[model samples]
Target: MKFLFKTDYEDDIRLFPHSGYLWTYGTLLVLIAAAPFVLSSYLISQLVFVSIYAIVGVALLILTGFTGQASLGHAAFLAIGAYTTAYLQQFGVPFPVYFLTAGLLTGIIGAIVGFPALRLHGIYLVIATISFALIVEEILARWESVTHGNEGLRVKTIQMLGTTVPRDSAGFYYLCMGVLIVVILGAINLLRSPTGRAFVAIRDSETAAKSMGINVSLYKVKSFAISAAITGLAGCLFAHKLTFISPEMFTLQLSIEFIMVILIGGAFSLHGAVLGAIFIVMVDPFLTFLKDDIPGAIANFSMLMGAGAERAAAIEKSTAAVASANGLKGAIYGFLIMAFILFEPLGLYGRWLKIKLFFQLFPLYKRATFKRQKIYVKSERNR
Candidate 1:
């Protein structure tokens, strides 16, 4: 049983509140540092992608989870960053300058979108974001001169200060990991600051927050800008990672996947972003494997139905259905979102908390210790 007894106010707010956390984080860092040497090239590449998604996930968490704003158009910000980097790189701009430029430009766009839509909440805001995403996708497709339309754009190797990092190189992977670490630390610090508190305050109760003199509208716009900036940085890295990108890549499905990361992992917690990224990245291979195995399973089942022309025709239809099911990735995401929302609102992080508490309490743990409670009230105002 571990106890984190706070000695002072500083201890309560410290990033790592206990000595156990220090050792655990230190060990995790050491393992990450050694991963390039110990892991296969494929695994290393996957981790690179995980790092990129983790950055985006954290950005969404800040906006949706902390600020209580919803955006179904985050892919638009990503598309902006990617295209910005691709366009600027072609003009001989260095990686750092173009990268930061992408974030800045995307942040400005986010603020523009947020200014008018921030006043709207719930489904109205979601619809607005969805419209924004569709508009951006159309722009990307129609702007053939700049974005090359559906032909897509090829990205060159990223060049830092006198150093070039190729997409497949270990240096590129380390660069991504380094950026992820920095973003995680920065997010943690931001969440502990006054600005982060204001975000949470707005999320909890905008009316109460306004009563306390918090500028609700300004902070909402700021939240959008900051979230877009972070996601845009991830997009810059994503472009370099893939070495090629098309407008089709930043679809509504991609935005949904971003939301899934925080939803399944735990929206209100920073670790949830990383956990969700890992789950999303790792699950892709499993899904692919299932896609492959399903056809064989279906064929075997068809054989068991006995040999006949009618059976053969039915088997063929089943085979086609199974093959088409590969495109059900969006359906899978929707199912996962629904399941998490209904059964585990706090997400995987919440489950982790419960397990940790169980272990801490040991034999004294009660079955109802972590059970959720429901409260209902009848209102005369409704009548």
Candidate 2:
């Protein structure tokens, strides 16, 4: 009898209010589209990274978030796609054909790797995928003639229909935005389909899903292929945009970053991916600045270092730049993962949806209970 008060079927069915979703997404889309006009060049550049992460986050959402498959080798797929772009350019292949070939090739590799998932789960599966990523890195670093060893390869300027796209920040931002919109819409449509249902079912319970006549193995591999294909496309864009490639760029860190994007974003939610990407990318620089300012501002730091003010300033700047380039991002990423798990498991989008729904259903509600929950524990509690 106590359990009845704790659970509500009607509430479960009404978890995502229709009006709220519409208003929230509609407003978000408008803001994203208008960002270029109001944002700084640096911000636009950051937004380009956000867009790239959005695409990768969506891919991670499909495999790990939607299908509940743990993967730590996503960077390998990105590497495959990037290397393919470089390889095709070397052979003078057209961009369109090259991208298609890269996606297909990466998908094939993803499917093959996913085969092991048929018998593995949890940490075992994660280890296998991570091993696969390490192996890919080893190959990229060792294959001298093809991969150019540690020297890395330079990417050419993007040419579409004989016109070279501008290599500046604004052009790249717009290009990334276009790709992001298309990918997001495509992801939403896919998740609304039968295949998407199968993936979700498998995520919930592979045994039950298999019992219901879904081929678990086939769907798992198929989901991985789709996820990898999307990541591959993002990689192609990333490689072309940077006009450079190296094995170091597609390391295990890259894979961890993709995972962080989705985890920080709500799992199994499309908007969460975009929201997570935006928040994470924007916060990265701020964290780096904080790291630099703290050390420089400390009184003990000035006393301990006999170095002159000029040297100190230079050291501070260099350290700040290094933090900005790498260390700060990882620390913040880890912090975000932990924080989201503790406070907002559904991520920023989930919180936004809650606010939208609350306003839409305000004044009439008798109980203090929210129509849509944004808090971390709400998912399990709602269930």
Candidate 3:
């Protein structure tokens, strides 16, 4: 219901459109600052996961959401960041230098991939990214000298300045939260710049963007590089958070989860990335709890269905089979993605906007106020 009337050009482009936004954001910042002391260690760890995913989610949003370019292999960039951090630490590289280096290396690799992928579109681009992910995984597994292969690599203690922050400590949590805030602010600023507008123009219509004199190819590569750099920076934090990582941890499924975060939360908006990260992190424990209880629940149901010894044995076997279906998490993610695409394409953020608008308009709001509209151009049909 809040409204802001712009009186000058500065008001139109200001980061905080009104006093309400300023106060709201300030309150959120205060809450984040106090979270470490108020929340338990387990909850803080979960928040760290949220922070890590939020960073990566913002990166994906830039490329896939803002630029209309799909990358199914972003997890590879994360792995590159993690491994780079790990290897650099062995040579006694300072934390800041190694962390920045990870991002730089991954950005270079992403631009390299983007260069060859400029000719592809839609599913073809997706396939190329997926192939890139697979190739990276294979290389990580085979290159034992550097990556340590399937045996995995343990991260050394994280040292910044003269202080060492343990993974389980609140200092580490603050580090992650601080980095996430910086990245979010940077993204907000970037999207307000001319470069960000060009990316959006390419996404909406490449031909039109080209007609406007935008360097579509160069912008696409730049988007990839920037996205990869942010994602890679996130991976550096992720490596320290877990203190151990292997090729398996950066699988295609992980990449899909990153995509799912943005898709479910809302792709076009930066807030969507944060919301998606929170949803994913909060839902994870519930899924784990369900995984633990499902077999017992199935067994109980089977017992209720029959009472014979043979029936009991059959029920036990069925329970075991059902219990072993850890793939249920992946299935849930896939289902959510399909549901969002078909029924609620704009995602959680879009739904929230509708609700807010409906309340703001109250009695004047029509049922069709938020309905989707189709725009059909006769010229395109004729062609």
Candidate 4:
């Protein structure tokens, strides 16, 4: 009997060991670490942008997705982070210190914001958060002395350990990717911990969670702080990447875009954060190419139909911006969200999981019988 127990324990340990996950994770880390040398400059830059967005998206997901706290003012945190990093750069602070400070400052702000959630519910809290965002914009735009009042602030090349990192695309990409990996892994760990579960419980039912002796208020606030911190890190990266900071960069549109990413990627899933970021950020370039390369009616008709070179040039000039502003990103995001809601509400990862399950039992994968419907059925019925 003892041998049987030991054998089962060994099997479980082998099958679901920490080393296995670590090995896979470490391998990924190595790839990301070495990606800069092999990847082209353009692709590297794209990946860097992806990393920045992923950081912010993950931050938002932790708060809204896992903690069930709706935050519309997340850009406020990003603003805080950007300004902080810019200030530090202007003042000649060390890179590591500046980065950490950015996160810490935003985290403090987020904790303060979370306090209202203790007393408010649903849209009430959402409104307050939105108001906070608007207030931040006002500050950024009006604080001419500090924020430069829409003139924007310049960010010098980020220096690490007294050595200036190259501002070239590849170096920047490597740096962003490295930061992204750290933040992502940290988020994953947080979600796997007791604190994360507490957030989830509070999100699902604060009253029930409280009844079960969970410190709902504390967790809610903590999640907000953590979420803000993650975004702040992203903001720091953004400032460094762009070498500029402006109120316009952290607009309400950006806040909405972040939320859209969360919705499209699947709320509360880390993988969703990544997938959403890639989708939102990549859509612009992809569509731009489709416009130029495809040579369809939309492109040629507009080009040829213009009254003359003056009008034609003007029309051609507007094409890029018009294509950009036509709300295709929003439309695609809305469609994706609706599709996920209707067909795969659990998001892309959920669909992938179902497909994997289908393949795992391929020969046994039969049509759903009235007695045994595996894909979709009432939870009560399944039991």
Best by lDDT: 3
lDDT of 3 by residue, 170-288 (tens): 99988999999999999888888999989999999999999999999999999999999999999999999989989999999999989988988888999999998998888778776
| Residue pairs of candidate 4 with colliding backbone atoms | none
Error of 2 at 194 (Å): 0.9
RMSD of each: 3.6, 7.3, 3.5, 6.6
Mark the 10 consecutive residues where model 2 has the least summed lDDT.
Answer: 1-10
lDDT of 1 by residue, 1-383 (tens): 76677778788789887678899999999999899899998889999999999999999999999999999999999999999999999999988899889999999999999898776887789999999999999999999999999999999998787888888778998889888899889888998898999999999988899999999999999999999998899999999999999999999989988998998898899989998889888777767766667666666667777767577667766765765575676677778889988988888888898888889888887867756677586663542
Reference-based TM-score, model 1: 0.89
Please give the CA lDDT of all the candidate structures: 0.88, 0.80, 0.90, 0.79
Per residue, candidate 4 scores C-alpha lDDT tens digits across 1-383 of 01223445445434225555678777977888778888877767778888888889899988899889888888889999999999877787898999999999999988888887677767777888888999998899899888898899988998877677765656677788878878877876787678987888988878889999998888988998999988998899888888888898887778887886777677768888888788778877887785675434445666666556566555666665656566876776677667766776666665565566678777775444212235654453322
Better of 3 and 4 by TM-score: 3
Residue 210 C-alpha lDDT in model 2: 88
Choose 2 or 4, whichever is better by TM-score.
Answer: 4
Candidate 1, superposed: residue stretches over 4 Å from native: 292-324, 367-369, 372-383
Give Cα distance to truth, residue 266, candidate 1, Å. Answer: 0.9
| lDDT for position 188 in model 4 | 69
Q: Candidate 2's C-alpha lDDT?
A: 0.80
